[model samples]
Target: MRISDVLEKFDISSEREDYATIHDIVESGIVFKGTNLWILIFAILIASVGLNVNSTAVIIGAMLISPLMGPILGMGYSIATYDFPLLKKAFVNYLFAVVAGLLTSAAYFYITPIYQAHSELLARTQPTIYDVIIALVGGLAGIVAISSKLKGNVIPGVAIATALMPPLCTAGYGLATANWPFFFGALYLLTINTVFIGSATLFTVRLLRYPIRFLANESQKNMANRWVTFIVLLTTVPSIYYGYVLVQKENFTQNANNFIQNESFIEGDYLLKTELDANRKQIRLIYGGKTISEEEKTRLSQRKNIYGLAGVSIIVQQGFSVSEINKELSLSDRYQAEINRLKSELSHNIQQQDSVIKAQKLGGQLYKEIKPLFPEIDYCSASKQSFFVTSGATRNYTVVVLGSNQPVRTNRDLARITQWLKVRMKSDSLKIYIEKTAI
Candidate 1:
């Protein structure tokens, strides 16, 4: 058997549906009214809620049910076939759907009590070159699925992979919260997804040799081609810049991590935590055991260049103590400084004592509230804990410790409990630890 003959066995032409059937399917989906409009609205709301609470399952459900793909696919198909009327209709309906989705999600976010930006919401606020690739590949897969006789689960999978709805909802979130950065970032990401997906569809449609509906003269064809090219380029060039920014951020983070893990250590003080802020190009190190001298800090900062962090700033903070204060002061000055330190320590001690008492009371109240829902929970306690975060800062989190007979095995159950705690406590920075008791 020849190589060409063997390759022919894998040809997709045999399984493709009729061109007319494919055209009808694409055209039928372009209209966003009645069922499709309602579905898009509901999907947007669901996605917003998912982002609000950071629920992966809910977000996936929203993606699966979204009807936003129709007009995007239609736009691509019309461009490929030179169907100007269909393109206009698709563009109009696409605008309508986007407006409706944004409005619905914005309304939900504006009225919701939980206003914190969860991890899921934050994820959509940035678009990298990788997102462009996903959108393009997903568009290709979507067109192939639509053209095939046996679609199976490809369409829904493509819809989820392309992720058209979440970014829109995220932009709505930015609008409701009056967070311009979030709004603009998410909008840019949405543009990336939209432009690339449509571009991919156009490429695939041309590759499949879909019949052109409008028979035009040479001048008309050139004009139409110019418009399409302009639109694609207008959306694509910015995405390339964003992709470059993303690459720079990833490299900074990697270098910071390497420096912290291997290079950042003091001779006398013990490093407790290290925080990296890629956006600010800063690294902060916290020491607990002892104070670091200015000379040591200077030496440490000088080593940054060796780890590919020449322009990055390094900040070092040490545990506070009266003994760590400068010893060059006179006796009177030293005494006054010691007295001030004692007063500050006393005040902090009293505040910490009060916080502990309040935590105990809150823990008991939460246990009572959660007992009925999770009968397996035998004990619960809540307290405040300090930790370093990605922004080169320390944060205080409400930590809940739970003792249960059976382990919380499923992520759904864990997420449920976490969401409940966050809402009840009105604390976005909350952590839960479950300890398994012997059966």
Candidate 2:
């Protein structure tokens, strides 16, 4: 076959869904009627459960089934056709749907026993340039597929990729957990998806030459067109700016990943965790094994620009010493003696490490003041250890407090102090012990 013939056969626009049919599909998702309302609530519940349990499959299922995309497309149709009444209707319904999703998910998360931020949930909280691209593409694909005579799985797949449900659920989790950052980020992502999807639909409708919803005089038409242009322009400006920022972040993150891979040594230290704050232009790395030397630190610092983080600051934290744990295993026969020794040494070591971490976060001046507080307290510091009991019926997060030469306070006073520390540490499974400083 000729290349022209082959191209003609695959031309999507030739077989695009007629305006009437496309309108029907978009109209179905615009209203919050009985069935749509029920489905939305159900989808939100399913998404919330998926996020709670960190289940990717369940989340995808929720996304595919969600009615959230309906109002989004409806809004686009209204904008493209210059139907002010329809636009108002669709906008209201979309707001209601968002509120419903957020409320449903938030209610679910509030009572759940699990409060941990799992990977599946965390994924939705951060919106990047890639997410905007996915959202825009998904919106375009969805409208095109809806327009087609036969839509196999294109709409469903787009729904999954765009992930409208998960972000709402994530925002709910943040609200329930009182995590403002999570709430803001997830909500921001969700808003980005919604606005872009509507925008994409408008573009597609205009391209398809869809009939206008209402007839108007020439002056009225001009005014309507001006308003549409104004709205589109208003939306486009921020989206473009945020998109640019997201692209920069994605590039920086990609380069940082590459730099880390290049720096990894097979027999030496390995990366454990990385916290990249793109806005602050800071990279924090947690490494296991030996601490990085001054020379190696300089080498890493020098390579920041090579890794696309030209103005970024780098902080590295090494794992705490494991000699105590290793040596304690060998001296198990002298368990009692070593247990006391190990506890003291471990607590001191943790204190030093904590001091260093705090220093990096707060500053060197903060580290200097920590020593003076040592004389006022009866304990050097505290170390947290978790393990199962002999009965295996329970696990304990024991907080070993290394005692100093100062007076041992009353039990009530100590209890209050421990409670204060538990709040500061954000752990409810905490148990405190005030052991005297080992000789």
Best by TM-score: 1
Question: What is the per-residue lDDT of model 2 for residues 321-391, given as tens digits with 9 covering 90 to 100?
Answer: 43432443335433543343444455556777987685345323322343364443443444445587788
Please report the TM-score between candidate 2 and the true structure: 0.62
- Model 2 whole-model lDDT (C-alpha atoms): 0.75
**Which predicted model would earn the best lDDT?**
1
Can you give the lDDT of residue 416 in candidate 2? Answer: 62
Off by over 4 Å in 2: 1-7, 10-18, 217-439
Model 2 steric clash pairs: 17-147, 378-404
Worst 10 residues of 2 by lDDT: 362-371
Clashing pairs in 1: none
Per-residue error (Å), model 1, residue 278: 1.9
